[model samples]
Target: MNSKWLWPSIIAVLLIAIWLYLPPGIDPVAVPADSDSIARGEYLVKAGGCISCHEGSEGEGGLSGSAAVESPFGTFYASNITPDPETGIGNWSGEDFIAALRHGRRPDGSFYYPAFPYRAYKGLSEEEILDIAAYLQSQPAISHSVAPHELPAWVGRWQMLGWNLLADWKEPGREMNDDPEIARGEHLVRNLGHCSECHSPRDALGIIQYRDEFKGGEIPDGHVEAIDAEALNSWTEEDLALFFLIGMKQDGEFVGGKMEPVIEHNTSQLTDADREAMAAFFKRGLPASP
Candidate 1:
């Protein structure tokens, strides 16, 4: 070996070692067939935007994921998550589900691309995860096969090893609001809602910038406005809550674009109280502007 290049080669080997070795938890259990748990799971799934991301185009597919997401990296297709024995998660145990949600690892022990948004979901409680699993299990099995992600030719699943190593996440806003409802809303926004995933901008590696969270930025299509108190000050919390259900603004303009599905499937489905909580959560710290 050439003496001059020896050090570089050693460093490259070490980097590979780190990536491979770090190739990275949850109880393996069956979901209860009870309706209550399943119901809760259904709600959580909606809150988590499972349908928005996994639902087939125009509601034709039910968690038969193939929803295309355009990003800088490439167009990634969501995978089927229905209870199909062959094509879906029918074989996945509760632990596999938990691992996928909390740790971003597939049942095969491979790293899932961050497009799955497991980083934000890591905060979910074990019971919440179980409920989600229950809800998914109850859905009718669909043997829909999904297309593989069309990321750049240079991008590969194996490359995720290196990508995961550099993962860092900051809480969006940890200020303890005295109001329990507001706190719950925060939990939903940060975790179940995964609101920051879209509303916030990302670094070069496509990680959400929690510190600048709700201070929206650009997406593949266009820019998302900041949703912080200052930005939404003109609207009362009541109006905000109503917006979640109706997707209409006080200005009479309806929310469209990427948020259409989110409103139609996720936030619009929330209970009134939960919607109020979310509205209060977003509008916290500022009184409605006169």
Candidate 2:
């Protein structure tokens, strides 16, 4: 190498540039949740399928996340979220939690890697976000410590900020349709469900192809089947709803793999209305063409 100082100088300049352009400061605010909100939060957490991601491997960790999510960028370890002061998110204020979901940012305003599915979560209502936070507050504290992800050299905070900008990412306005049912369904499917995160393909930079969402793609492990209208045209809404319960198909067979755990921990717990909403969403298909 010509000089080690050359690389250090370049990094220092980049860091300084990023610091100068940092977003405005946001103070952490704590919002205490009532028992009712905590109860509701449990349901929302189940619907969001937090367990599938937060629950560690058989012995690695607990809801204090240790699950590794492998992606094109690199392997990412899910953060410890259980209410443990030192190792988990116990110290985070309710606003901190909300900001994490709304901005893909930490309390300090540092960027969070999108593996947490915050993009899908950004549109969630404040009440919903608070409710989820309340539920997290009630969870038993698990003091599991997870290691940091070793991001590739090219993916710094500024890189992620620019990437989000390219995708037109911004705060959610949360407009709805004339029909409340359809609106509710859309919210569950598009935001809380985050079904497309796994089913849809990502571009080279890891941004989800929203246009082709629900059209299956290869994930870190295996390929998921297309859940788009064209792909599921043969399956009626009724079929889709039933599948959510037990993974049974019209042919009397069952789906296995990653979906099995999803049914057990997430779908089976959802109310009938949410299930129908998801099915209805599938039948209607993407609002825009793939």
Per TM-score, the best of the predicted structures is 1
- TM-scores, all candidates, are 0.87, 0.86
The parts of candidate 1 lying over 4 Å away from their true place are 1-24, 58-60, 169-176, 285-290
Best by lDDT: 1
Alpha-carbon local distance difference test for all models: 0.83, 0.79
Name the runs in model 2 displaced over 4 angstroms: 1-29, 59-62, 169-175, 285-290
**Per-residue CA lDDT of candidate 2, range 1-290, in tens?**
46978999899988976874475354565555789999998899888888888886667555878778888788899888788888887888877888888878886777788888888898787788888888888888887779888678876765667777766553334566666666777777778878878888878877778768789977778898888878887888789889888889889998898888788878878888888878877777345333
How much is the lDDT of residue 42 in candidate 2?
89
lDDT over C-alpha atoms for residue 26 of model 2:
49
Pairs with steric clashes in candidate 1: none
Q: Which ten residues in a row have the lowest lDDT in candidate 1?
A: 19-28
Collision count for each candidate, in order: 0, 0
